[model samples]
Target: MELWFTGTNAGMPIADRNVTSIVLRLAETRGEFWMFDCGEATQHRLLRTPLRITRLEKLFVTHLHGDHVFGIPGLLSSRSSLGATAPLQIYGPSGIRELIDSWMGITETHLGYPLSVCENTEGIVFEDGDYSVRCAKLDHRIECYGYRVEEKPRAGALLVDRLERAGIPPGPLYGQLKSGLDVELKDGRIIRSADVRGPAIPGRIVAVLGDTRPCAGAVRLSERADVLVHEATFGGNLADKAELYGHSTAEQAALTAREAGVSRLLLTHFSSRYGAEDIAELVQEARTLHPNTDAAVELTPYAIARARNES
Candidate 1:
């Protein structure tokens, strides 16, 4: 899996960073990608990357802020113009339905594909065989939220060498053994799958939070996550201003990651006031608490590798 940042600024777009929009690309999900927070000009930002509008399967809106949702209509309209026939799903807080309805109804925009809008999004918002997504209400100016995406654990690899050692030639029996079943060979020997399978591969956890201050909801969603994408809207020196604006400073975000026991911290949603040098300094401040912290750059794809330990 990888995270591609389309926009990384806090409230508004600057010359370098745009507002908040992120893409989650999973290798096991065919060519589909899930989007979070489509800010203004998000479609234009996607054009700069290799992500296809047709492959956008779902959108998770964090809040109703203009900086987080102004691009929804444009993105939906452009998807239709680009010939995307696949259905799309959107999940967000209570007023999201009215917001979308007003936009589509006022513009008279007709989409060729079916669009499902899910409002009052919380608890287990989405779940399938492969993954589950849970949302928690966060502390923001409005009713914002944070999402936790967890991948299901996969079966262990079949130990072909051990199977060969047991004189079991490769055949349909291999499939049964891989499925954790006991297979009887032609010689009447019972082969236990447990004896020939490696350890189970643990699933990955990714937490993506919207604009918020340090709160328990953020920690709950980010607890033990492989990657925690939190907003660092200001520098450590601006902690007071950050709290007043319902945003987190870089230092505060890092402390949250540490408290959550997350494996990695990705700080994004930076203020436009910070230049490149200032952003680097903010990252450094975060590193004092969480050594694995990094500033998420726009249009950059951050790969999430599997953890070495199963825990």
Candidate 2:
């Protein structure tokens, strides 16, 4: 899986960054993506990237802030124009349905595809055969939430050579064996899949959090994640200001990452107050606390690889 930061700034648009938005490419799908936030002009940002608008399958809104949701109406309208017929699911805190309905109704925008909105309470908001999304309340001014996307473990590769050594010819029974099912041969000999199949391949976990102060919920959601995407809206020295504004600094994000034992930490949601000169310091500050921290650069894609199991 990969993560692309569509926008990274906090309040206003900066020279280099936009607002808060992230794009995650879904695994085992047809070039589809799960959008984390739809900040203003987010669809416009997608045009500059390789992510296709038609391939967007879902959108997860963290809060009801204008910077985090002002682009929803425009994006949905644009999607219809782009000929997206597949249903789209949107998950967020309460009032999300009203927000969309009010804008769409006022503007008379009718979506060609159906849209599904979830209340996004605490628990598993979405789950399928491949992945499950868990939500946790964050300490933001509004009812913001953090999401943990856990990719399900995939089955190990089938041991064709082992099957051949056992004199088992390839057929539908081979499919059963690959699925961890025991198969009985025509001669009445039973073959156990455990003896032939390799160990299961572990899946990767990614946690993307919304705007909030450093809180326990963020840490819990990001526990042992392959990648933890958190916000660093202020400098490390601005602890008091960060808390008052319901935001986090680079140092706080790094501490959360270290505590959660995440493999990598991606800091984002930069405030426009910090100029380009402050970029290096912001990243360095996090790195000093957690060696694996990196600031999210706009339109940059970071790859999350699966952890290898020992033999």
Candidate 3:
């Protein structure tokens, strides 16, 4: 999977950054993308990338801040014009449904595709055979949530050479072996799937959090994640200001990542007060606590690879 940061600035757009929008592009087999926040001019930023509007399958809103949701109406409307016929699902905190309804009602925007908006979200929000997403309350001025996406472990590849050595020709038996099922040959010989299969492929975990002060919920959602996308709305020296504003400093985010034992930390939602040099300093400050920390740059895609099994 890959996370494409369309807008990384907090509060408002700056000369270089837009706001707080991110696109989580799934694998090619999934053929879809999930969005986190749709800040102002998000679609505009998306246009500069190769991602298609039609493939946007879902949106997870963190909070109702203007900078976090002002672009939803326009993005949804544009999706219709761009020929998106597939249904779209949206999950967010309480009042999310009313907020979207008000926007659409006021604009008289009737989308061609069906839209599903889920509100008052908590715990497991989305789940299927392949993946599951969980949300937890965050310590923001307004009600906000952090999401943990856990991909299900995939079955290992079938060992064709091993099967050949066992005098088992490829066919339906190969399919059964790949599914971790024991297969009985026509000659009455049983083959155990485990003996011929490779190691189980571990799933990837990613935690994308909303704007909030560093809290236990953030740590819970981010535990051992492959990548934790947390807001660094202030520098290390502004810890008091970050607390006052219900935000997190880069140092706080790094500490959280280190505590959660995440492989990498992606710091975003930067305040406009920080310039290039200040942002670099924020990253350096974070690195003191968490060596694998990076400040998210707008429109940059960060790849999250699968974790290797300890065994």
Model 3 lDDT at residue 10 = 96
Count backbone clashes in candidate 3.
0
Candidate with best lDDT: 3
lDDT of 2 by residue, 107-152 (tens): 9999999988888889999999888999999999999999999988
TM-score of 2: 0.96
RMSD of model 3 against the true structure? 1.3
Clashes of 1: 0
lDDT of 3 at 216: 98
Better lDDT candidate (1, 2): 1
Tell me each candidate's TM-score: 0.96, 0.96, 0.97
Which digits, one per residue and each the tens of the lDDT, describe model 1 over residues 1-311? 99999999988999998999999998754788999999999999999898999889999999999999999999999999999999999999989999999999999999989999998456999999888999999999999989999988877899999988888888999999888899887788889989899998988899999999999999999999999999999998898999999999999999999999999999999988999999999999999999999999899899998865863
Cα deviation of 195 in candidate 1 (Å)?
Answer: 2.9
* Superior candidate under lDDT, 2 versus 3: 3
Clashing pairs in 1: none
**Candidate 2 C-alpha error for residue 185, in Å:** 1.5
